[model samples]
Target: MTLPRMKLTDPKALRGYAHPLRMALLGLLRQQGPMTATRAAEQLGESVASCSFHLRQLAKYGLAERAPGADARERPWRATARATSWDDDSDDPQVRAATDELNAAQLALYTRQAEEFLARRIDEPTEWRAVTGFSDQSLYVTAEELAELTGRIDALLAEYDDRITDPSRRPDGFRRVSLIQLAVLSASPGGGPAPAASANPVEATPAAEPDAAR
Candidate 1:
């Protein structure tokens, strides 16, 4: 009810959540609704046993829980939160390390999803193709301004939280959209690689899908 977002601080909890399947499963449950392991396996093209095991693991870490109507023959699982939040700059070394691992895993998963979308981009409907593509922008702002900007973005996202949490409110043509926001403080000029020209841009290597499916 409080716009569920898990605020994780424990290194142990962070490490438990860094797994690819666990992250994906949480996303799926949040997007959809309560689902049995069999249903999740079917949607993900994975094994029911595997999903069941990971769902249990997620429950162990307080990321997920058994749904209210679940019974022995068909237990349903639901995400405890709509999203996860953590501070990247923790004072503890162990917390920082676990945060790094989770961040890296999320980045890898997102990159692979992006590559997969690109592979099928050409075949997508013309309207969607026209509206979808990468955009790059640079802005100079102070730390306070950056925090304010992120807060404004979160406020914007909150406007649509109801549509996400309640499937029935979704519009006819709308589908799930992933919004990724990455902000990094800039160093002095010449501190890092120079900006690329508009004509030619550096490309990142395509990421392979996580091994959790196997």
Candidate 2:
């Protein structure tokens, strides 16, 4: 099978995967390979109708798309992009809303997953050791500046994407979560918006579901 290429659009894609369930749907495809709406709904504990609606939304944003030969029937859908990252670059209100909502949901998902990972590790007595690395900071930058920073950070993290898989790197139970808490670090101290001071962690991966045992 051909690896899916990134088909993320400027704003439409952002709006598409903003919902909690929609993001979960994308993960279903990425982590488990292509799947039909019915299967996704079952895994997600959602109704087939709801899952099908979410799948259509994903397609609208050019994120996950139906298989090449898929018809109107419930067919497998594959993710177009492996991962997505963005910052407050555009001034358009609609796009910004879409982007911000997507970001909020995305961060929440990852945050929850991180918590679960720690809880599980604490309960289990496994050879794999627990590890933690995190950062929080303040910065003064405009949307443009933040966008540039986000890009640089993404490139840096992508470098380590396959490091763990390579036998040369030496395997360990070690895990890392890199979170970029970028928002208004000053005036809007309540974590204002995306173009604020962002701390880019180097070891973050797509959020993991809490129940790995499943």
Candidate 3:
């Protein structure tokens, strides 16, 4: 099934969701399906109370909701959407500022994850090591072309969306992979002198979702 997506426009909701732990919790729910606060805390190494509180806050902002539980006393929460997005081009200053904060938090999360992978990369099996790690590239394209390129990438990743919710769909040796795509304008028209080249440069890959915060 195509996972539902949540688009945030309200400044209050954007600010509330711009927290590190909250983003982590939302990502956990999306990856593991519905889970109780205690279970989520165990996976994330956070205290049960802290996870519970943040889960409630996520629901308040419409990013998450209560799912059917094992019994009356059990409360399981699930992400309302597989992807969360926002308008980076909002005219409202409050919305823009809130999005900026959220973007910073998201970048921090990605950086930490990348660092963790690098710290243990040497120990990974040869095949895994060969396939893992990052690459980058500099592209020259029009704004419309960039949009088209990102859209195509999103479509390609959507082919595997079902595997996220169905464990049976994943084949043996399959594991989670994080793909971060960045395509920012490096320089403006007739700007400054060209920067020095790096000794080693990498290729670029587009991300799975457009305007997705998580």
Candidate 4:
């Protein structure tokens, strides 16, 4: 069987989803499961008025959609998809610009989040550790080869995106894992690091149980 090729559509699905608040709104809904705009606002620490505005914007981008509810006014929202992957394409100027803008903003946000998370983790009483590791090897390949490697890395990262929420696994220190992958262009100047942990990941019991429980 032949596999279907995937390419971003015109105007690009990402263009509509690139705004900061809209992106944050999606993250909020996904992490918290589903909730009304008012509830989302409370969790986000934003005013209900502002949260309602962003939730609508999220629907506009097709990143989120209203959930079933008794009243139209009580409509809740949920994230549309588990993941979206994109890469550089210069043949179309519009695609190139949109992709570039989205990628840059994402990188900046990730770096800031990761730094803040690590900084705070140092002070927390919990038994958790932060680590960074890398693999380096020389390969003789064309540009396409390198790009293919990146695609694989992204798929791997996506696999771990939603499974890192188990808190009970925390004490063991390995029950949960957050995968952060980054591929860069050397010719073009780059941004910084990956996004940090549990600004508000879903609640799960820590990995290790209490002594009393055992």
The global C-alpha lDDT for each of the candidates, from Candidate 1 onward, is 0.73, 0.62, 0.77, 0.55
Sliding window of 10 residues with minimal summed lDDT for model 1 = 205-214
Candidate 2 C-alpha lDDT tens digits along 29-129 = 76666788888888888999999898888888776787853567647887776665565667888778877777778777766665655565555443332
Give the clashing residue pairs of candidate 4, or none. Answer: 114-196, 167-204, 167-205, 167-206, 168-205, 168-206, 168-207, 169-206, 169-207, 170-207
- Which has the greatest TM-score? 3
| Ten-residue stretch with the least lDDT total in model 2 | 205-214
Better candidate number, 3 or 4, judged by TM-score: 3
lDDT (tens digit, per residue) of candidate 3 on 93-153: 9999999998888787677667767777788787667676676556667889989999998
In terms of lDDT, the best-performing candidate is 3
Considering lDDT, which of the candidate structures 1 and 3 is the better prediction for this target?
A: 3
Q: How much is the lDDT of residue 119 in candidate 4?
A: 60
Candidate 4 Cα outliers beyond 4 Å, as residue runs: 1-8, 70-73, 124-127, 130-141, 151-177, 188-214
Q: Which stretches of candidate 3 lie over 4 Å from their true place?
A: 1-3, 190-212
Model 1 regions lying over 4 Å from their true place = 1-3, 69-71, 185-194, 197-214
The lDDT, on a scale of 0 to 1, for candidate 1 is: 0.73
How does candidate 3 fare on TM-score? 0.85
Q: Which residue pairs come into collision in candidate 3?
A: 136-202, 136-203
lDDT for each residue of candidate 1 in 2-94, tens digit (9 for 90 to 100): 336678899998888888778778877876678999998987778999999999999998989988764567778887776787888789999
Task: Arrange candidates by lDDT, descending.
Answer: 3, 1, 2, 4
Instruction: Tell me the tens digit of each residue's lDDT in model 4 across 1-214.
Output: 1112223354556676565555566666654556898887776577888888877876775667888876876778876654445657668888888887776666555554556555655564454432332223334456899889877876865564434344343344344323344544444345334335444333222211110000
